[model samples]
Target: MKKTLLALLCAFITSAASAQSVSTVVHPEWSKNAAIYEANIRQYSPEGSFKKFEEYLPELKKMGVGVIWIMPINPIGKVNRKGTLGSYYAVADYTAVNPEFGTPEDFHHLVNAIHAQGMKVIIDWVANHTAWDHPWAKTHPEYYIHDAKGNFVPPVPDWADVIKLDYGNAQLRSEMINALKYWISNYDLDGFRCDVAAMVPTDFWNDARTQLDQIKPVFMLAEATERDLQEHAFDMTYGWQFKDVWGDIAKGKKNAADLVAYLHGEEAGYNPNSYRMLHTSNHDLNSWEGTEFDRLGDAVETFLVLSNTLKGMPLLYQGQEAGNTKALDFFERDPIIWKDHPYRALYTKLFHLKQTNHALWNGLAGGQPQLIKTADDDHIFAFSRSKDNDQIIGIFNLSDKARKFSSNDPILQGSFTDPLTGQSGQSASAPIELKAWEYRLLVK
Candidate 1:
């Protein structure tokens, strides 16, 4: 009986190995209902270590942050580096954890902590380039992109800090795949958010997705807005064009009517399951363009209202919920000063409402957004989201002054309570009044 049991155990192990060795394109169960949270390790906390950030798993879980997308944790290359510590994208070693962040054991602890909170962790991946001091740069020089003079060049003309990778080499592809597998199998990483995905070849990503799915279920988010990148690989793509349009409208360079044409283009250009990440602020905007306060101006609240009600996954960047006013330096050591603020209360209420509103969910599972035709459509934006008996009506004043807007849209003619306050409102034949930057969220 002992001999028979040993044989059965050996067979089970072999079967499991074979299953993991085979690649697939389908994702497993952990990612479907998940919400993504961005973790900027350097600026997230005072210590900026994996150990330090691990303390927030419970709070994140409480706040409904389902998937934790950690910024790059690899050793920052120093040779021709940009800042004191160098860019995280300029990786010195893909296989090892950055000593500045923590040890490999610390990372394991962090991943375990996130998992213990019933959350998933997908890390940021920059596979298109590497730091000049990367070992592969010296040992396998041919793997890098060479210029006319046979010298390795950066990915873009202005990217003087890092070296570009050559994708035409099959050996490089195999090595990258192995590195990815090592992380997934050894650390239990849930998925990846690929940086500048449009710069990389599509076939490589498709292969990577297939290889990753074999080990476990994974979620893939691409930084590119290209439609063909979706295929069987990525679950979501950046809504960059929409974000640019928002910037234009805020600057008075474009009108709110532009959103209609953009949405129509997206509906026809992308896949049905192709999730678009909608955000008010991200790393680039906070670091490069100013904070949401500067970019959105008095229209901030109105834009935030539309961001959640739109047909996409809403993103809350770090410090955004705290009314972050400082412009974070991208290449240096800057910690977000976590403090008591009004934006927290506003976000807490808004997030709570978003969670409970079935009509405001993402994609086909959510209701269609219908704009409420208003008299002052330029300054006052009114819209409604409806799915069956469930509906949410929103009205916001984007201009600098208080405004009264008349909307005759039947969708906005419902009786509902403003969950932000306990007051109930039943619309009549008259127009609704709103103060500058003030917004209303009502549900029926």
Candidate 2:
């Protein structure tokens, strides 16, 4: 009887532990079919103010953007600031809005306006570090890491504008959590996009998430790609690997098989419910690297389609829709040159399909990509994701040369129409011919 009771107790303990591990965080319902847009408020318009940026909310909503991830709006550090206008990541204050952007009241109205448009807003949070001038350096010196000489140090050598924050201090953790809570409580923000999230202790984020959720369900996006971050803290992480592989394919180094392998690897590595943010270009990529047009060449639209339909949430950076060729200045006000570009229409079609089609929904709410066998698997990539009555089939010609391919996969047999072009009557009976850097997104 003693032996049996001991065995039962151990099993019960193990089961409880498993349940606790799996139930760390619950995602917000609105995020399931949402496509996130990174709004560079400072560079969004000529004025680069909240009032100016707010004028385009209707256009964004119509463009099918579900969530708006605003870049840092806090006052930038001036002591060791970079360029005339310092980097957005070098934050001096956590709670106050940057006067350059607008008054705190203006920001409040902007957030309310975004919510009113049936969309969500999240602010970029630089948790790992702060500007050298941040008050914490004087009042709460213990909150930061110190050098042997007792001077403050930057997290990275090149990041001289900011000082590294130390999560080892319990008081610092509590204070940071309080600051995070302040935004949600006051502004009613949907969530935060934590910058360099992995640099901060995972336990700190876990605690933060728990406390934030107590206020309201929030969507957390981590800039890092660490898988463990998703298990507890973040709802989504950057799909840097996918972006790299896509770039390689465009450069003629990696092919379709390599792309498929990366997708398979992602499936095995991340939980089905974990959201990966896939994008062709972002603030960093566009500024540091070249524009998507420069890197992907003519294949920019082709990769954009894959990023939208593949098993993850899609991210659209500001200016991408306008086919903005110039990499806007990161530290200065370089407004996007908006024009009636064709990419805008393409993005609208893809984003709307993602919202309506259950197959392309984000995380576990959506179906997984099943590879559809094609004759030219090397140069052509084809796959289908279906949920209930909704289905989307994506076929891409990854090479610079046109390719002809045929697929006998049962999923490809049904009649389908191209969502972007509205052309119908495409079927698996005839071979498909695609031009170089062209893609066909068929929906049924």
Candidate 3:
């Protein structure tokens, strides 16, 4: 009987350990309260050089930015390349910097400058495919996926300039991992924003995360929204559904009720410890879809506030603060016209609030959002978050018309200050009015 019991106990222990998720994996200590800024080197300045970008580091740091995610720096394949300079995603070599951006030494200097400014850096990685002329096509023909005719093929019909990689090939997986490690070993990069991470196998990402952690705890951001990816391989995933819902609201097709439902659905579906990246604009959205102003109209800042204060890590894409109002030319040189804008100050204030308020921290480090009941739930969205002694309440008029609402929730009836307008006072169940597309963020 003792022998049988011992064996059963051992089996149970192994089962529990095996069930541990990638979400529980080790993360760098620095990421606890971090916010990410996506830097598109090409569109950031006219020169599109790393050295020129390095000059903007101090200003970004002053804005309370913590992590900088630079777009791909690898050389692009000339064969079958698209556009005037080729897509940055069509990587020709994994280990070298794009000469158009600058030399490898110049990149190193830029990374050092970012570090010197007390910020972390992550590079965009395109592991799902490579440029058609990538040496692997000739040196390791077996490493790529083949069409029905047994010829190398692109992953999708539209991505003709790049060919897909076959993760099924063990050697290819090994080589891909080696290339990932090479960047960390050589450039001292903090982590990666994996492009189309869902196209690659989850096991490969799990293994890569494990191996990369052996060198140093790394932050991984997946461009996809697979929950399993966050379980062990990624620290964060794209909040695609959130963006979709917001877009619908901006278009007057959805309302605050829909947002509340989404919040509940997200809470029930995603792991409590998983971080979601919230953003109003990104490379794909700004270049392919449309700029936030074009999509959201006069409600642009309203949506931006929702992204920042929501229960996730906020993402500020390149030139978003300056309100780059046009869809940038994806395949040609289109530089952002930098100027002093209210959006800059807005982000600076919101980012500082995110860093200091434990109630607003990322993932498990922060508070769970408690939806505050209010009259006119269809137009007025209200919620509060509390962690320890810190508390934050956010109320927004998501509709195009002005909204009037009354809230009797005890959590909101107290002395509070509005971070945006600097108004402070005790609250009651009295009716409150908000202008069209206006929001209030109260803190105690």
TM-score for each model: 0.88, 0.94, 0.94
Superposition-based RMSD of candidate 3 using all C-alpha atoms, in angstroms? 7.7
The local distance difference test score of model 3 is: 0.88
* Candidate 2 accuracy as lDDT: 0.90
Tens-digit lDDT track of model 1 for 169-239: 99999898888888999999998889899998989998998898889878888999876777767878898
List clashing residue pairs in candidate 3. 22-231, 22-232, 23-231, 23-232
Better of 1 and 3 by TM-score: 3
Ranking by lDDT: 2, 3, 1
Question: Which stretches of model 2 miss by more than 4 angstroms?
Answer: 1-24
On TM-score, the stronger of 1 and 2 is: 2
Q: With candidate 1 superimposed using the best TM-score fit, by how many Å does residue 95's alpha carbon deviate from the native?
A: 1.6
lDDT of model 3 at residue 148? Answer: 92
* lDDT (tens digit, per residue) of candidate 2 on 135-191: 999999999999999999999999999999999999999999999999999999999
